[model samples]
Target: MGLPWYRVHTVVLNDPGRLLSVHIMHTALVAGWAGSMALYELAVFDPSDPVLDPMWRQGMFVIPFMTRLGITNSWGGWSITGGTITNPGIWSYEGVAGAHIVFSGLCFLAAIWHWVYWDLEIFCDERTGKPSLDLPKIFGIHLFLSGVACFGFGAFHVTGLYGPGIWVSDPYGLTGRVQSVNPAWGVEGFDPFVPGGIASHHIAAGTLGILAGLFHLSVRPPQRLYKGLRMGNIETVLSSSIAAVFFAAFVVAGTMWYGSATTPIELFGPTRYQWDQGYFQQEIYRRVGAGLAENQSLSEAWSKIPEKLAFYDYIGNNPAKGGLFRAGSMDNGDGIAVGWLGHPIFRDKEGRELFVRRMPTFFETFPVVLVDGDGIVRADVPFRRAESKYSVE
Candidate 1:
């Protein structure tokens, strides 16, 4: 009473010309190009530098003329120190690995797209000398599967299971027991760099692609209907409904995964003080003040600086205990420290406080002051620790 599986196979095999259409080839090429671009982006974009900042702050780009907005608060600053001057921090292998997995999924979807297009096109039946089953009517089902595969790959990659390394060795460990592979990159806590966060956009995009494919299939007519209502029409509606249900499920599942995977780790020790706006503003004033007070040129200050302060461990250690003391030498070889009073309270004999109103050029390269050995700032100042040279090598 029902059509058997062999009949379906016979229908597909009999229509050889349908397997190679101009439209199918074009769609395959487009899908392939998209997949290639995804891989290219993953390879060239270093997450530590300015190139990857845009992706991290996805929607911040449209504010017009605020292109460098993402870099304003030193968000693009090097996460680690050591290595050559050109490479200050360790490369983010997690990001690279995640990108590769997402790209693989895209490639898989592209291949599936080709297969669906090739097999679903209308073709004459060799048995009856007429068009047999309307194969294109089932395109929605294949499209839905392709979308699911895309989402699954992205989800798997974000879990760190599919990547070269794991995000956390023991994800279920106690807060203090958990350890990140790289602490310099700050992957220890619940951060956006987690797999779920990175893969979310990819999953959303895949879901939308599936929805579009389903819509396209719904609009295409398999055969003429009686008063525009027939069994084929019912099949199209049912397929679209099933696609919608799957899409909803994916959305819910992705949300749940992200929420659970990104929960913050409660450490046994005091909370680390992350850099914030207030801290930056205070440090800026202090460094500038010291430079102006000493009348030291930037190059002069840089030359006098020691090397210990260049490493992240120097700054990141014991963040909760008042954190690292932020200060930098001015371009004019002067050192500054932020004072509580508006005017420098502890002024030199010349009435100059250890504060500067203006910042020097190349301030980022200015030496970070670990300690103020002498009460008064001077060009030949003694620093407990300093980073005079670039940490590239």
Candidate 2:
């Protein structure tokens, strides 16, 4: 049976309630970042700077840059763009201008989102901090700008400081869109700080939101969200406080654990690991294939560890147990054509390996010519191989 009605309701309310709380917090942080950036560009820095106008748009901006993220409709496999940023990510596609452009564009918009709130905070509430994840006056700019401040500071830490035309080692992806920015704007810089894709990223952003929510949600002369705990008739106390913390933690863990940050084992678990590993494996496959096209066998090229590891690791071959390979060789003639080259039990040829037994052990031996008897004789060794060469004819 599925569940009782009461149990189902309990599950639904608690889980769904948590989810809704998380979503709101996420959007608020992002929106705050976005709105803050807009205000910063337009009002604080004399105007929306007109140069980064593209950031004004939303997700659509990411479409063209999907390839850099190892994503594409046809998976056209990336190649070097013949350009090098002296301090580029050795493993990231940020080295390429196209991907850099797309990611940078995303960050640009994010920057504007945060900047706009700065203007709001400065203009609206000169004395009070705006209510954000946990600021002072909920409506005041203090909280809003603080979220913006955290994000901006984070972004600056990631992307700025790298001079013009230099490939940045943007570990954090905060200044992700720095490449997309025009040189005229002079926003590009080396951001050695604020690395990205860690569990901490979500945690930090969440904490910022929590702080904003606390200050905003708890303030008197409330914003009637009806989404908070009520301390008094019109006053709202941190209604979603606990949920907010959980939401942030979940977001951090979820994003890191989810597809966004696939570790090496996850991507090439059966083979390679992580996106970088996948890319490297793909490169290896390409190179190995090219070598095989000439004279090399595919077995010598492609990695066999994944295939062998999974099969044998899962299946048993213990002395006390039975397996695909028992005690003796699977083939005849000792199954080991011993000589000077290659494994006696196996072939160097591609596809031929399919016929070879992986579980069986192959062995044979050769004779030591005893001139005293006018002939040669042999002794058996567990790992010996069969002799095939003689010139009696």
Candidate 3:
């Protein structure tokens, strides 16, 4: 009679135990929904059949980047291609879909277990009579899991350090640039190859994350920290939320623009370009097209693609283009063009130079180092001495 649903909601909201139960139920529901959808995808996916765009395949309930195989006709839409199963440590589309199914099952079981013990007062403090979720410890668990995942991907995956041809597409080759990790500081130079550099970054980050998690789980926060952060207050939660958003934003930017993430060319295509407002893959496709037209073979096309040349030009200081700084080339306005720091200038068999690519370090952005033949490091200066006009002793 007297607004029964509102009364029921009030009752549920008031009880902390009930609230936890609701959370579990919510997780279960979401997991079940996602799992069912993923199951459908797995069931319908066929290696032999043509892979359509996810929007066309699943209509409104499309998974954004689910991997697919076979000839694709997306009708001008971007096609998401799966990794090769033959490639070592690469997870195929079907494999990931299966993993989703397993995860759903585990979530369902967890929900059921929580439901059976609905009256358990785990997340509440007996003395305070308030929700006492050990936030640091919980966060530690998440960090540990994330760290393991990142480390695993970096150490073993096809797009990581071990993946021979999949790491990067540079002037040297698809293989990563292996710089010495000796001295820990600046011994030789800091030239991180794509994919490999990305992999190493992940590995290092993962290690730090794991250690931080362990520290958090083991140690108790000081009273000063609690006071400083205004813990147990609504303001703290709001601040944390804002901080989380900014952190996520920075991470996304770094991963996409700076190549910090494990997302590989094979998985998500090349890095987005500012020229197209980061809308679609244009440059890579164009290069591939030109390569294919010239060579008339898919393998040769990929091999001949000079995407790195465009990359060099974008970064500035390319001598081949007669730019200001000579980061890659050894010549200082001289006709004799030489490569910098042993980084090779890739050329086709027809004597046409493809690219003289040299990945710049933080300091290397300004031309300070003098190199001998074959781009050997001979000497270096402190200040900016890039051009031949600014010759110094």
Candidate 4:
């Protein structure tokens, strides 16, 4: 809605006489959020504060429903290595990029909601008497700076950064080179534009951004927390709360469901938006329905499945054809371990399990075509790895 309003009608929408009200409101909201985030990043890195936990302060998110920290890995996995991004913008098992997008959308909505109730005169009008600080000057500067950073910094990262293995998604599956969070520095095969290493800079920026947000609000004098309550606020809050819950369930339940049942599709996101969990979930159901034939057992039909081997090469390696297999230690031959079947389970021909990987993708979460040693015929194995490293058992 924000993008549409701005994009489709920027001239008219931003016209001082037209949608000036909306522009001011949305701008303020964006300003507050973006400014706070930048400020939080700064404070989190304060050398004076003795809390030496460099990145995400583990166990800080004590919400009972929350699991672990909101931190995610360079790629999709339990641990965070390549660039340790913490508090990661939002919460979810769907990984970083997806979470980031969701938060962006959420903040957009919150900003929109702010304008629906209050007039644009002040950040907080309910405060007793005129406070020491001036509203126009403070919010005015904050609004400008925040807008600049959100767009400028955001563009710098998206356009200039994003190295190989930095991990992003696609309509079909995952694709990226192994790289770092810093700008343009990584393993030889990865993207030069994307630098790899400890994302301490990000940590500092994020922590300070949070602090700035709190401070900005704190400086807004005082108002009852619910001062802005209105019919629109209630309706919007209720609607958003419902949507948030549903989205959470979709990402979480979908990951567990798909990761367990079908071949796990490794997703690398700039944020949580990178996870293709929804696409694969629907595809799994569609394939399961089509695979079930009259008088044919599901198990029998499983092995007799079709292979959708799309590509035949990687940036670095040759293809693997025929029944021959290359042993890639624990990765089962994937270049950068993150293909189908996240969990590992070894098996020979037939249904018996030989050795099971701790977090096999063929778990109850997804539909499985159990491949023994002779399995993986479904792989574009000729390519560096299977469709997703998670696909292997």
Candidate 5:
């Protein structure tokens, strides 16, 4: 049924103006989400408070180009390292939130502009006398742009080899020899930009994205292809999108759970099993407990801390073996520890000690099925060390 003149003038309906209105509404929704995220980051941010634990803390997403030039969240007050940063700018929580707010404002303005020009027939196709949009072309353009960005960052080793301030705290404070968060998956030592670790991963992904974008842009997809992909109709498209969302979700979940290289140790923190009732949080609690027990003065107890790796023996079910395993004691031919056991450390202004990050323990690092001298498997292995029943038996 056709709408009345008054209704059509005042409200949006199934007309040419509806396309413009939908665009405006979509922009507004995106703006709202960005604004909300900014607010949430602001709410959680506390400059005065210090999170001593290195494993768990608020995370920030930094641009590769900006970070490569040493523009990052170097504000040391938020973490255990307390001091003024040498090269700090709009890369911290405050800066990211502000950027989001600015983006949201721009989106809102664009939405308003679209709303004002709702009656425009710019999108109307001359042949059909109806609005038409090239969604595939737009997607291809987006992919191309994203691929270029990723390729530029990864190929140049923007964050790992070049940027010192991102992985570690206060790049200028220390010597030029800077190590990455996961050196095994990154360039190590004072080598000048050798791209092989996580950089390779990014480069591969970027290349694929670029190729996909080019294919979409140059070639007109066949009807059979659209039908095969379940994108022939709006209903099929929606269902396919839902399936894609779930598939992506499961992939991410598996990566995080298994602690794959995709979820880098530097960016997303350690795996769930490593920290969830395992060594990470346990060591932190043990240190605090020791501090409370030893010191008589209640006021000065927190300030006076225990040494790093001090209370390792006290943790776990079997205290006799201790938290760390010695490679020297073993009768193996190589007599060398294989895994990268290093973790990020938090320090004071004068480079004095504060706390050490607890990475994976000996048993977790090297999965050894203990064997007796008589070529038989030993029964007394500390498989499940912690009291928490979550760990593997």
Candidate 6:
């Protein structure tokens, strides 16, 4: 009843050459991705309209697949006969920061994978025959070093060491501070700096990865240990199930405790507010009237409004302007939420102005309207403000 000779061959869990190949491959792919992103960030980034920027909006290798599945679309606007129409859906700063964190995460994971493979190869070699190096000790040292890097990166994001104005939002009014959004203000901390959050996740995963690697290095059980543990045993099954249940309970308890805790504004900067649609509408109306009196088109006047708001946002959110840090020091939030107004305006079939209240849910056709030579709202489109409310708890 014994197994056949060919079937009894040992399964090779670790091969030095194969592991080295995988490590090289992983490094190459990660490096390539990082390089492409760097090029886009530095040489190709366009601050004025990042959505239309070739560098910022360029998709990775997998983007085509996503686009085919109707998951993503080109982030740009259309040009009409009178003026250019920009896509209101795209937010440049948010998009860039998001891409950075995502790529950084991929590289982090690759590093961990390489380390694991190296450790495994060393472990297999040591167990099979005598190796010159102290593999276990070396593996532990590597784990410690990797853990430090992960911790440092995580701390950097948490402290906003990279740049000022990189803050998180606290909608529950946990953080008593408020941020200015150009002509108005709203609650901050709704969206945090992406890198900071990514760093935290990386640190957690890295810690677990290192721990598992170290545990394997420290505990090299003999073949007898595997033989003694019978999978089909009722006692073994009961013990494993009990341990799983306890672990699940611990996770649930920890999540609930964290949720109930007060918002940590100190760890992540204080919450800031932004200008709502009402304020933006008032400003727009004034500016548009002035432009009309001067014989300027609505598109031309509206175009300058964003630029003006952006300048104001910079001044208000600048850490030097009595923010969280000192005047000379740079310690402000990312200011992405400040300068620009949300909501895109379109035209109806009858040439009436249509302001989108919220983000578009699906593809819907809307007419595009243009102001006539006479400084009048084409089709007498009435101006309206998008509703936004604030409260303190």
Off by over 4 Å in 3: 1-92, 112-116, 124-131, 156-193, 233-242, 253-393
The segments of candidate 4 whose C-alpha lies over 4 angstroms from its true place after superposition are 1-131, 161-166, 176-393
Minimum summed lDDT over a 10-residue window in model 4 is located at 308-317
- RMSD per prediction, one decimal? 17.6, 21.3, 15.4, 19.8, 14.7, 17.4
TM-score of each: 0.28, 0.28, 0.45, 0.23, 0.51, 0.33
Q: What TM-score would you give candidate 5 relative to the actual structure?
A: 0.51
Per-residue lDDT of 1-393 in model 2, one digit per residue for the tens? Answer: 688764443332323223334444455565455444433322222112111111111112222222223321211222223222354343333233344444545655555555443334333334554422222343345445556655543344323432221222222111222231221212222221212332234336645865775566566555564334343321222334556678878865553343232211111111111232333334444666677886877656443323322221211211122333544321121232122232222222231221111222221222322111222322222222444232111
| Model 6 / residue 273 / CA error / Å | 19
Q: How do the residues 1-393 of candidate 5 rate in per-residue lDDT, one tens digit apiece?
A: 787775453243333455455555666676566556645544643333222211112333232222333333534324223345555554654465466667767766766766676656676667886755554665577678878877666655444554442333221111111234332243432222232344555666788889888877887678788667644343443466579779989976776665543433333334445543454345544556676788644334433433222212222311112335522211132222222233334333444333322233343443233333343433222345653232224
Model 5 gets an lDDT of: 0.45
* Most accurate candidate by TM-score: 5
By lDDT: ranked, best first: 5, 3, 6, 1, 4, 2
Better of 2 and 6 by TM-score: 6
Query: Per-residue lDDT for 216-270 in model 6, tens only?
Result: 5687545576347643233454466579779978865543333211222222112
Q: How accurate is candidate 6 locally (lDDT)?
A: 0.39
Candidate 4 structure, TM-score to reference: 0.23
Model 4 residue 224 CA deviation in Å = 23
TM-score of 1: 0.28
Tell me the lDDT of model 3 at 51: 23
lDDT of 3 at 190: 32
Q: Cα deviation in Å at residue 52, candidate 3?
A: 13
